[model samples]
Target: MATPSSPFSFLGDLFNTIGERLQPPDWAVHEIQNRAVLFLNHVLQQEPEAQQRLLRQQGRVVRFQWRFVTMELVATPAGLLDLAPAGSVPELTLTVTDDSPFDIARAALRGDKPAVQIIGDVQLAAEVNWLVDHVRWDVEDDLARVIGDVPAHTLGNAVRRVVGALRQFVGSRTAGKAGGSAVGPAGNAE
Candidate 1:
């Protein structure tokens, strides 16, 4: 007897098909890339060391690719990021190896980095890895600037709890599918 197929597998295929067929307008993609650069700059500004490191690599472009989407960013002299000029060649390219969105999300929720294939400048890639390891956004602090500290703390705690619950649920589901071993938050089998 053949094993039953997953009921939700079709949804993944449907989403992939739709995503491939329906490309966003170039203008919208440009605007979104601009916003992403702004947000990245904002986060970089919070870490002086990150900015200093980036400043050292000024003019070097880094390209990120996932599926059909690609974004290229160049380091500025001021230690901030900006969109690379069209047709600019990247010194380093980082491509996410994972093709499934759900798997990516699951890995993220489990506090794991998705598999990535790195190509090009080793120094640039090392700097980028350092930035990723050191820099983090203080979401609660940002929220507190708009609201009050007490409310922001409470909300942050709630959000953390919800995320923890989601992590647990996803872990359990994955474990059920893969025998009995569960993957922990660190992506190690438990």
Candidate 2:
């Protein structure tokens, strides 16, 4: 089984820093657990810490909702943690769904929490592969927020941002001296 989240790893330090900030109402603690494993693939893009990260991210989104109890993985050093309530999970229609490894992984990283759950009947367009899973929802929603409606161009923009972030992240992980960093001998490949 996986360990607790890296984000929460710093919670002790965090709470200590703001211990006297505010106390929540008793009723506020009553929440339902609505988290999952795949939604985090987009945020981390590593595809390994699916459950721990995605579930946390999910928890965060639903936290402020009427039935809040989900965590989410933000693309920061500290992975999954508390998220604001997501309200109702939106219903997005996936063109494909077969529940295969890729399908499962996609759903794991892409399915909405009780929202647009990608089933095994829909199909995935090749272009969809370019996006990070967690950010996909935000990317989709962001475009919808900016433009009165989602045009073909907006979808491209979202994908572009996801790809850019992914490339930048991966680049840093594998960057060289030319990239403004040098790999230590232990960090370098044999």
Give the best candidate by TM-score.
1
User: Which candidate has the highest lDDT of all?
Assistant: 1
Q: What is the TM-score of each candidate against the true structure?
A: 0.89, 0.24
Could you give candidate 2's per-residue lDDT for residues 8-94 as a string of tens digits?
337544654554466555445333222333344334444344434444334222211111222322222344433333353422223
Residue 61 error for model 2, in Å?
19
Q: lDDT, candidate 1, residue 60?
A: 99
Give the poorly placed runs of model 1, Cα more than 4 Å off.
180-190
User: How well is each residue in 1-190 modelled by candidate 1, as lDDT tens digits?
Assistant: 6644555567778888999999999999999999999999889989999999999999999999999999999999999999999999999999999888888998999888899999999999999999988999989999999998999999999999999999999877776668876566788755
In model 2, the Cα lDDT at residue 118 comes to 39
Worst 10 residues of 2 by lDDT: 59-68
Worst 10 residues of 1 by lDDT: 1-10
